[model samples]
Target: MKIAIIGTRGIPNHYGGFEQITEQLATGLVERGHSVTVYNSHNHPNVAKSWKGVSIQHCYDPEHMLGTAGQFVYDLNCIRHARKNNFDVWLFMGYTSSSVWHSFFPKNSIIVSNMDGMEWKRTKYAKTVQRFLKYAEKLAVKHSHFHIADSPAIKDYLDKKYSVNAKFIPYGAVLPAASEEETLRQYNLAKDDYFLLIARMEPENNVEMILDGFSASNCKKNFLVIGKTENKFGKRLVGKYGSDNRIKFLGAIFDQETVHALRANAQLYFHGHSVGGTNPSLLEAMASGSLIAAHDNIFNKAVLGNDAFYFDCAACVKALLEKTVCTETKKTFTRNNTEKIRQQYSWDKIIDAYENYFFECCQSAKNESYVSSKRWACK
Candidate 1:
């Protein structure tokens, strides 16, 4: 099948989760004998026409200059480019900016949208922006021929709200190989001596709350915050907690090896993301065999189940930090999470699920067309 993937910055995965997924999925699909093209931002680091076996289509993106509003222009450019292609399937990675241009999508192609997290619920956006996002979400549902939900909770919400049976396909991760102990030396840290939290310093991610809890706790271990500190919330966090020598604000580290090493060796990994379905970082931490203490929410609970610890507020995080768990329990938590990664969230399994789902959607579209033609003939 000819597939075109949209709604991400680029393919070589210089950015975050959606780009990473696109890189993996596009390459995987190409390897499986399907022609796949990924729409990338012109400013993306990788300027190559192709990476691995997947084709790359670069479009102008002005997000750097225009800020958030530039994303709409970028998506519009990508859609204009995509309108020229006669692809069999067009997979939208998310419905944030592209959904507004749903009318421009190819008339013959099957439109499949991966409805990301509940965007309106995010605390980062203003109320007006949230309302716009909610309207965009509805537009995506009403226009697309099919929907893909990365978590069961999201799927349930879509089914109830829009009366559509969205397919449940979560993100995937790879289990990291054992790393050298020398990696810890660079950070001036010992194995299991520091706590770790890796996420964009966003309000929905609860970075500040986690830091607050850690600062209030009696634990003397260092708490490493691994994300860019240039954002407003991040700078505020740095100012508020920077005085504490134990709370180290290590700026964004994209190196997978270093990140996996940190996750593998940390005493505990805190996942504070309250939005989104099946976060890539949480899966990475699990794949690295990190003992997790996640924010108490349906999204995190749906993935961790009974395997990891849960916390709701700052006090809960503080209590968890101070509380002592036996080595056996720690082993159980890590082991269970890693096992979950191996069985459910492996890259191979995710690729296979997508491959099968795409074929199903194509076949379903064909059948519906045939039925509609038959009714027209009878009329």
Candidate 2:
């Protein structure tokens, strides 16, 4: 099957969850004897003609100049290219802007969309913009031949909201082996001496609440935050909580090995994302064998089960920090989560599931085509 992957900044993941999964899925598909083309943003840092065995097609994206509005233009450009190429499937990773172009999609291709979390519910956008996103989401569901949900919570939401069944394909993470703490030396850190939180700087991520709780805690260990502090929300957080000596803001680190090392060496990894399903960071934390303290929500509960601690506010976090977490307990949590990951979130299993679904959709389309031809002959 000829597959075209659209709706991300580009692959080799300079960004977050979608890009990471896209790179994995595309490369895996190619290895299984399928032709795959991944659309890339012209501004992607590692933009190349091809990476591994997957083909890369760069499109015009002016997001740097026009901000969010430029994404729509980029998606439209990709759609135009896909239409001319006659792909059997167009796998969209997100529909933030492309859903509006549902009518323009080529008739010959099947539309399989991954319905991301409730993007419209994010607190970062204005009310009007959020409303627009909600509308866009509806259109995406209406037009897609099939949709994918990464978590049980998300699958339930779509089933309730649209009364439609979607394919449940969660993201996967690799278990990290212990590596040298070369990156932590720069921040004056050592193994298991600090708490860590790594995520994008956004309102929905609850960076302030995590910092507030860490600052108020009686624990003497440092709290290391690994995200860029140049955003408005990030700057405000620094100004408000910068006085705490125990808190350290180490700006964004994109190196995967360094990220794994940081997670592996931390005493605990805090995840405060309240708006997404199956967060990549959370999976990474689990894979690194780190004890996790995630936000109190269905999404977090669904992933961590009994292996993690939960917190909803600064007070809850402060209280949890006061206790002495024993090594035996940490070891048990790590062992349990590691087993769970192997059983449910392995990369090889995820790749196989995707390939099977893609082939099933193609086969279904062929069957329908055969029936339609017979009906035409009878007429």
Candidate 3:
């Protein structure tokens, strides 16, 4: 099958969940002997021309600063590419891009969109942006041949609000091997001496809350939070908590090896996502075999199972700190969760589900085409 995947920054995994998902699925499809081409935004630096087995098709996005307009620019360009190359199917992620492409693209094209979460509910967006996002979400559901929710939590949202039944396909996780000792030395973090939190410093991520909780704790364990510092919210977070030597803020960690080592060697993994479906950070933490201290959400519980620890407030965090004997039990729980993730959330398994979904969407399109042809013949 010739597949065209769009709505991602690029390959390699330097970006967020969507980029990682795109890279993994495209590559996995290629490995299965399917022809897959990814339309990546040329705004970001090139990580690779080919990742795993997937081919990259870099495209221009000039209206980047215009936010939603920039997305439209990219989507239309990708649609043009799809039509020009005669791609068999079009798969995309993100609600805004999906909404735009589905509304404008050829009706016969097999379109499968993965709308991961109620992104409009995120606090970062102002009133106007949220209103637009809500409408865009509806457009995405109404127009796509099929929609994918990264978690049951997100699926429920779509079902309730849009009356749309989407296939629930969770995100995948890759178990990164331990990095060399030199990698740890480079970050000045000794193995097992510190805990790690790897996520965007967005309001929904609850970075401030996590910092307050960790700060209130009496545990001597150090903290290393790694993510981009481009946003104003991120800068304010840095300004507030960065002075404390115990809490180190390394801005924009692009190196995969360094990130893996940080997670793999940490005493614990802190996940502060107050919103969204199964987070990639949480999945990556499980893959790295780190004991999780996550926000109290059904999504987190579902992903990590009951054995993983949860906290709703700083009091709970302090309580966990008072008893720092989490080493043995936490590791055991982490290993158990790791085994579960290996069985359920591997890239091979998730991508195969996506592949099957695309094939099904194509079948649906063919059936519709056949019916239309039959009606025309009768006419």
- Backbone collisions counted per model: 0, 0, 0
Ordered by TM-score, highest first, the candidates read 1, 2, 3
List per-prediction Cα lDDT, in the order shown.
0.90, 0.87, 0.77
**Best-matching candidate per lDDT:** 1
What lDDT is reached at residue 186 by model 2?
65
Please, what are the lDDT tens digits per residue for candidate 2 over residues 266-352? Answer: 888999999978888898889888899999998889999989889999998998777679888899998999887888898888889
TM-score each candidate. 0.97, 0.95, 0.91
Q: Model 1, residue 208: displacement in angstroms?
A: 1.1
- Which wins on TM-score, candidate 1 or candidate 3? 1
Candidate 2's TM-score reads 0.95
Model 1, 122-200: lDDT tens per residue? Answer: 9989999999999999999988889999999999999999999999999999988887477898889999899999999
lDDT of 2 at 66: 93
- Report clash pairs, candidate 2: none
Please, what are the lDDT tens digits per residue for candidate 3 over residues 205-318?
A: 877777887888777878888888778999998888866778888877767677777887887777888777878878877887877888888788878777678888877766
Q: List the candidate 2 regions with Cα displacement exceeding 4 Å.
A: 368-379
